[model samples]
Target: MTSQRAVERGASVLIDAGSLTRCRHRLYLDTAYSALLRQEPENPGVRQRREAARAQREDIRSRLSETLDGWTEIEAPDARTASELTMAACRRRVPWIWNAVLPIERTTGRRGRSEILMLDPVDGGYIPIIVVNHKVTDPGRGARTSRLTEWAPAVDETRKVRSQLRDQLRLAHLYRMLDFEGIASPNAHGGAIGYRAECILVHDLTTVFDEYDARFLDRLSVARGESFTVPSQVSECRSCPWWTDCRPQLVANRDVSLVASGMRADALREQGVSTIDELADFSGPEPDNWPFGSFTDAVAAATAWRAGVPLLRRTDEVTVHRADVEVDVDMESYQEHGAYMWGTLLTEKGGPPAQYRGFVTWDPLPTVDEGRSFAEFWAWLMGKRADAAARGKTFAAYCYSRAAEDKWLLDSARRFGDISGVPTEAEIREFIDSEQWVDIYQAVSDQFICPNGKGLKKIAPVAGFEWRDAEAGGEASMGWYREAVGYDAEPDTTQRERLLVYNEDDVRATKVLREWMSDRAEIEIPTLESLRSAV
Candidate 1:
């Protein structure tokens, strides 16, 4: 049987799931196609499978004829003999023998290069085993291509690398039992006569029946049109390329079982049940006779299942105090001189603080908010301070050694400070040094934060707050934002909306983080002292 149009397909399905049924047929196809893709392309699995399958086919053929005197299969003894034997088998009229052989020459074209070879039963027709490595899909199956699909000709370089593998196979004298479809091109040179054949059946004797398991061999031999029942064990599917389609069907039909206990647990978890709700009966803390480790995990999984949800927990609660103040705080301003001045005194009354708050200016040029200038920002700070005083609230801000928040506020102050009578840059620097700001990052690293690097993204999540985006604009990078602002050109209204959305998201995230910090202190009270003392 000569096959001229061979095809290959790629997919991302994992071998573990019951969904592998779809991959089984593709696996067999891939095994053959992979031969066309290798550098010295020889797929031991494909060759072995095809040989074993051909053996079964020949067994059936011999049994059908009572006059058959003898039959023999010669394993590839050597290069010359293997090639000669294979060529003889293809040309024989009565005595049919299947051999895997590689063609001597290759022709290249737009579609892809094709390797021509003769196959068994070549008596009346040219059983050309034409090999092609290109992308194709089974439209009848309604299967769409994935990222694995690409423009065929665009990958000529990659194709050449793979074709070299065929060159090595030609020298190995291991080319038999391999046949493919015809080769065609989009350009000048038309295509060659294509060889067509029945589906390529692959079987691994070591797998279908193991070293000591031969009882099934008899059934496999005589069974003409029936699919012999193989072990439904998933391990059988896993190293097997056809695992995708065959394994799932086997499992659903109760033909296969996960023998590995750990694998069973994973399979169950994947099914969205981590508990005993459906698997076992439980009254309280634990279930009796739980098969896997940690009945607690199983119980959680079961609960999630009944609730129609995933078994994983996402949030942990935390708390903080209102009195962790340690430093003074104020906003800074800047002039064209590049010097800065701290102007808006927002935290002069409180203890040396651990953090600071600064107003971030949103550029709304061509539609500027006159009252929203830097000076207005300073006036707003004083207004907030006065309002807090009426309620007996002292503005105490805390800043770490790096003074990240302070630096931003300082810049803001100088840029928009009430220059009429604001403190000079030198005086502002003096007040900053007097605050004795602590460096939480250093404190934690040098025995702080309980053995973890000090990043707010990490800490905040552990404290029950996740980094979330409320809008797509929030996810835009600095480069994207700059583009919206037309960094080098006139701004558009659409860009203004994007910047507004981004600024709004920043403020919202900051507020959420502050609230999370307070909540964390309450939840982790037991560990609060350890965390602080560690630093």
Candidate 2:
């Protein structure tokens, strides 16, 4: 059900709700391809999202069953046949309904299923509630909320709202379907249960539906072959099945999105810089506030990409943050459950030779054991730092990107601070703010323009670094994590070893990439000074 494509047109009255919130090209391709080719199976990313949503919904239903009564769950022969069962459950005046499918709207032809349908006693109708895999609320106030088992009319000032665009639009899609059938609550509101499962996030859909209607119509037009759309690089492309169909086309046209994306790519196209060659051959003064790096850097990125260069220097001099002792760290996690491992490669400048250590827990995540593993890792890391400090050596820990490491560090402290050896949240903040931590990705981004992207996998090969495994990526590792921890079956020691090896390579890649940037980058990569005359 997390599929962006509407598979088996017989099961859908129109495009899926996701089309209103995702890339238009994905919707167009999904609609056009159903008739021309069989739909590709959902990728691991989509599968994980779907599974997480399912698990959350089931947990919500289980809690609701325990706390409330008069709940009916829709069960039918198939998805296409579930509409009647859902409608029957609704007519019974149940306070809660699970897995309810609303019939297609006659006017807009939208069909949807809700994880939960909450009855409004005043109107004798139901409000749609969706279950999602991420956090729905933040720590603050002024967000209207409801208890898990009941919806109150007044705002719950104790809770705050975090707006998730896709989840909101999905609620709008279901509400519209119910409203068209005259089964929607007069309240004109819906709710969602997020990963935290703490409370129902109430959304006033009056404004949201306005946006959804326009978006849904645009997607519907694409579906009915009334509009044209083209594929572009987007956040969703990393997991999109249609990338196979879109990538070749982009390559053939030398699309600008290959090097720049989002508003940058759109703005470039508007400026008549649609192709890589046009961007590379640009001869004018640079635009104000060019993203990531300078305008010359973007041109260099385009030129290098077009000419098949891996890395191009954007500055005459290059230096990566290094110290007398360094440790490269990488984290591996599964679908927001928890960070299961922290892999580290310790390289002492003159002391003992480099060593790799992994602090890992095979226990399936969302477990307290996670806290123990995290505390252990933190203790070991601090011990190494202290050892360096005692020896009067400047210490630094590196990661390709600080975002993931920062998130887990803060989260580990926040979630497990009470556990022995775990630091306080303030300590994590102190370390993150200090010069003792470095992001090699930032150093590379500051000094170079990588047309292919600055991902560790993309840049490591240029530094002559290679991973032993053929399938080495975050997505692939998520699959390995499932098998390694026995989330659905018996644990595989082989997969666990594979994960350790992959994690080790990731940290080692950062070590090598940093060294290459310090020692050889300026000499080997095309310099900005050289590309200046050419552009």
Candidate 3:
């Protein structure tokens, strides 16, 4: 057995004089382009250390081959394949170690040979050649010039080493383009392929350039040729990294705000509105030709514009925030459990003492009940409005001083509308607006005075109204009457009467609190922004 080693030291080679005579077997080790070649080993420890290093390197090569799929592993001839793999691994490793040691200069970096290797099934057998290259096939325009400049020197060096290994191993016949996992075709731009019929082939040079040794492998090439374009679709310039430089016309005149609004601008292409100006002008509101849906949509869009929030679909959970004064107005019906005409009172402030104004629905025909039915009750409430007008008091139904209870009041109003035979959403909106109905809880939340979390009791306290405290004492117990009705065998009949009484109390309480809020400064009142500022 014979052992021969020629150390390569950057384009220079050194061989031990004793190596030529030590054994019967002739071994020729060459490092023709390295400048750090040494002539001789000082001791037996050097060979032992080298063998250990070789084993470790082989282990790394095996692990890497298993780590990523699609790459072929190769071995070198005339040396133990494992030893060659290890040597290749060492070659790649040394550069990185040098890179860390002299990070600023990056001079000592060399492509390690893990990417190309030599293999020997037996521990001390002659290594056979196995050319393995990453089977990445990128089906796009091949490497371009601008891309090539960015390649790291380490990568260039690796290529050179791999090329040298291929030449030495006589593996040129195996030079068919193998699919590389990540090597994108520079010409194809972004196209991908795992295999290429193209004759391009990369031979394994892991004994020289390990994959990890070259961090710039992916960026080693550039694509210069124009990529193939689809007939109608054109190229995906908009998504390209060089889009700004390559397709200025397509990206220059963008309306940032409109795009930021999250409206699907792509959908508006059919309307001949590719740009924001075209969209704004073409979809401008037509006063006379207003369709309710279109009008609402436009309004919603405009609202989003002003609010600086995207126009989102309407949902029960998502509330549209407005800066307008929030008035928590509740309405009450004249009847207890029965459906009929009603009166509404609104209160902005919350407290035991509340003030409010009542508006009665006009119901000419009255129903027949033992007591005043809801219709008849409305007639009486209308009389109160007349009396207030006569006395120089505001006759409006909406109150801004206390929390209003208006569940029944709204139902009654709808009944009046039905009876009046006026069927229109606009009419309903107008009627509601005329009442100036403000949701108390919403108002408080908008005002930023209350926690804005839920619950009427929580909101009422902010306006100096304590509905809980007011109803807590035995002086007035709305719950007991409600319970009594429930306990009674005939709830509809008995509950109706008690419900009316409870409704009356609620109305009165709301009214009292309203008066206190309008006149007193002791209670805290918050502006709309304050209420919603928790976020």
Candidate 4:
């Protein structure tokens, strides 16, 4: 419910910052549905994760409360009035409000009419706070600025609002706004360092408010009339609640967007390219106007779309150093905490097909257990490398993506390693840079085009490898981890086993991709002729 309605009904309203920033059409449609129809209950797994996140936030808040003082939770007279008071107080440099609800009036011509801003206690004042449940050094500066503007008032009512705040005996100076990232870092003096927002950008807030005023009303009308158009972008479609109804229409019509990713679909439409068939059949030389940068690239993309395969650019080349033994590695991490498990699958030429091993931490609390697990896994890996060298056989670790694995390893070493047990920074650097570490994800993109997408689950099945559990995914694994760690209650062994199996399958999928690439000198480039003949 909007803050205004909530206040009128003597209830509390919770605002979701991300949802409030979405497309106007999406917001209106979702809001209308929520008001007019009962929403299907969220998936049980989704619900569990959400609950876990809430519990985590409360835990952090509790810890902070003990360290800080002079924070009070106050009920606003109404959502709109509260927002007006917030802006007035901000303009007058008033103290921060914890769980403050600022209302954006519909009459103000804004997309989201209400926002919630949290506060972190400061010496003799307060700083506006945005709490995120992940670890990241930079959480897009623009998004944070937008969020700040959302809390600010569009119209001038300084005198009236200030008078109200004075009458209500609630007025304090707000020092600044900051982002409190949820991820804990050993390097951080506290669990997080507050990132201050760029206040200069707040001036642009008025322009956005004016633009929304001009357009949002008409968009809302369209939504209420049930005439909202399905978005062409895949990311939008995938996240949309209306995907089930919209996807079939797009597929049936052979919408160009299904074949193209991102904003390129609109550019293609401007060039009179609107369908898969048209894109595939176009035989003209690369047009100088081609948005994809080259005629050849455009044709290659079209050809892949036509054949339902990933497009591999001609310049793309993939190479893997020949090794007598290979290990496919995939780490299952909970970004909310840290990497919890390392799954490795070993293979040898003319030897065993797969030897799966996992180094895991059973602790649910966010702590050094992940680092201990990583150290154990690394020692085991080094032992295997030494054995391979003694046998005069090259040994290599193959992973889908090096960034996550590399980052986790480096972070773990820095946080948990001792001088004698764990690999030093130099050794870790050499391992990552050397041919001993192979990133098959970079290899595939370098050698082949995958129109369907680059994710292992999407690409591995085409290479003839399948997960034992059909429902296994990153999200499911995270939920399993939560259950295993006893986030809600006692740890479940079944959940832990399921997590291991899922992670094992992920490494196995990488191995399948590796083997497929090894056997093919010229990567398979699906063509219309080949596709038609097979059919």
Candidate 5:
């Protein structure tokens, strides 16, 4: 492994690249866990994601190296020491140096390695360019870019910029190290090559420098024992190595994060309310810094959490939209590659028993075959709507959330308009906007308050729904997807069946949860009014 890669594995006390981008508490825990010799929990899901990202990074680095014909790539061993890198920069014979290490900044305790350095023509310094594994831009015309040839100026204007904070922060980290060497470009801009690999994406770090400095100083304080930070739940906790260690502690204290996380939890902590019990007992004027508009609802949600009740009705009764002819839809996609499967469950009164239909393709994604599969799924779903209209039956299609399904719906239709049975973008927008399309998640958000979480997995179980597969989850399914499609190994027929079952169960879960919301929530779930009375 490269010296930089070793640091990413997390056993060091010093702040390196990517540290500031994570949760501040995780940064502190990296030092604490390493000092106490606590092992990071072994997670197959995390390993799969890391390995895939690393593979993509290596592929990009190798392909990019081929384009820089005469640029020297410092050997991994030679790249370890700052003297070697500094000497190469001083000589400045070549315009670019690949895999150049930056000298450690002792004052801030920062050390890092870069993918490429473009020597400044006007001065002896160099500008840092980073290569990342994900796409940095969308198809449009705004962001400045350049040809992949040599240390080119970012003059290309073919693509629009995708503002990724982690990407920007990473560039900031590298640039800070360069600044310490007194060899950084006078300009605050940095270059990055995203998954496109077509050109360099330029970012102006002038806006982010303040954020970087503050975060670095904060992390340095944690590392040096100058400041204390406890684990606070944040979205980053999902994939964090310290999750197994911190989640237990959070739960043990019934930390307010168990209900309201991130800034909401932090805001609660600031008001001297740290546990569920404390938040539930608040009967006075709301704190000036309260994050939510409904302090009553917040307290009620906390009360349900303290009572170990998974769900609480917002009112005396919960009502869900139901149609004479209804279709429950769930999509399964492997990352951003493509939506490979669209599973549907059709249910109606006095009709043939509900049937489960899945339109899927095992073909490796990014392949044109994805268009065919998507076209078929779209064609079939629209056919269901057309059938409902012909029968003069009320119709609605339900999905947990529209963010993922709506995205791929338009994406699939746009990409495969030439194919038969593909809907137009305007058609998709009309359908999505109409009452015929219902997002059950929004219904749940309006009708119920979930304490543990509002995720499909968390809420569905409250309705007494269980998945057929023991490991039925998006992250687990992503790992199964690789095997089902022969991504790196031979395709497994069993994994394909597992994917199908998982997708079917997801749609069924939505149906079950919706029925429960409409029929059982009033009697089964605690009322917000009752929770308030108990408080």
Candidate 6:
């Protein structure tokens, strides 16, 4: 529900409580465009994607209704508001109260409030007003708690206490009477109970309410065009409609933000260093308040961006253990069906080039069967390790990150393996704890700072490796999986082949990164401990 205070205080467009709780600039721009132009200022593709997402949300809501029964739905007084709020309530499985203007008098001349209050029934006719929001994926525990703290006060103030008790009712007291709940899908597991629910009570609700009040006032002015600027976040900008218009200017001027990310760019700009050229050529003593803790580190990053090469900041931090027999591993999984393929590229000490292998599930299966497929992959990996041992060569399985690959290995073993299986918990843990399972991404990040990005797709190209499929990406591969597995239609053999090629490239990229780092021994920087001591 939107804050009634926000509406009456002259907000041009009402933002949902969930969205307003994060990224004020995004809300301001969206609101300003909608208010001034009467439509969203988005490109066709963005608009189409938004529409598709909305449809998916609606589908989830419909499915939720089928699962959750016997909940009464309350509609708004106005037809349009009622329709929207009703759908929202149905999806959230809470009773929605619309046209529920705050008791406070209108202060900023706006006539109507579009906020909807939801009520959750308790035993013996007790109903606590709840603020509900839905997310397609896990918003994380910290974020959910922050959202509850932000929304509680507004909900508390909307409470209708008796006239006699009104004098004793403070915002804090009201906040305690209300509740907040978020429904979120933790993973891409497409099932009825895949969505998890989290509820929280705000202890510092009054303080947060005051802060939110002031922040909303400032945002309202921006929404009305007092001031506006495009967000400098590169990730956000890439998907933004104005990116094409803004990118050329940023490039031509060598915007510092291109080299430095997050608040560091702003910090640099504040110091009158606003371009990569200026930063690279900077000769003055270190600024008194360097954002990166040390001037040399900042300069190293700038130099790397300017020269278009990875900057190894600390030689000793580069702890990637090279092996005579290395296996670069990458996995492709449809979250809906669990992990289905484990691809590996094997390289020997004097081998010609990396040899590719894939362990794939060729048929749709139950969760148990999926686990069995993973077990097979594990057996193959162990066989490779055994062959390397027989040849008297050290073997290591290298992956970009340990989080996913490691988790899958352990989880699959727990789900499918016998106590003595190749990927038993004990075996996987020993492998990971030893030098046998190398996380190249962690090693790269610990040693070098790549201004372009740290992603395999970004790093591999600079190391002279390229994917054959230009459209190969994590999301694109997921789409390819759907097509290949015939999730919605007949299986496409071409798509399956493309998926394998994509997987192969991913594993090969890790091998390429490993070799590239190994060859740069001469360029290694000081050890991290020494660098810290010097700083």
Question: Which has the greatest TM-score?
Answer: 2
Instruction: Flag the better candidate by lDDT, 1 or 5.
Output: 5
Best by lDDT: 2
Candidate 1 residues 425-453, lDDT tens each? 56446544542333333332332222122
lDDT of 5 at 186: 86
lDDT (Cα, 0-100) at 34 in candidate 3: 21
Off by over 4 Å in 2: 1-13, 35-41, 122-124, 153-160, 283-297
Clashes of 6: 0
How many backbone collisions does model 1 have?
A: 63
Each model's backbone clash number: 63, 0, 87, 13, 0, 0
lDDT, each prediction: 0.33, 0.83, 0.31, 0.57, 0.80, 0.57
Model 1, position 168, has a per-residue lDDT of: 24
What tens digits encode model 3's per-residue C-alpha lDDT throughout 382-499?
A: 5544565575554444323333234344434544444433223453345345544434334323323221123444333543554433443221232333233442233344534444
Please list the Cα RMSD from the true structure of every candidate, rounded to 1 decimal place: 23.7, 4.1, 30.8, 10.2, 4.5, 10.0
Tens digits of per-residue lDDT for model 5 on 487-531?
A: 889999899999999999999999999999888888888786776
For model 4, residues 390-507, the per-residue Cα lDDT tens digits are 9999899989878899887776676676634667777788888888998888876666556666788877877778999988887677778878988778999999999988989999
- TM-score (all chains, Cα) for each model: 0.28, 0.92, 0.26, 0.72, 0.90, 0.67
Compared to the true structure, candidate 1 yields what TM-score?
0.28
360: Cα error in model 1, Å: 5.5
Model 6 reaches what TM-score against the true structure?
Answer: 0.67
Residue 121 shift from truth in candidate 1, angstroms: 91
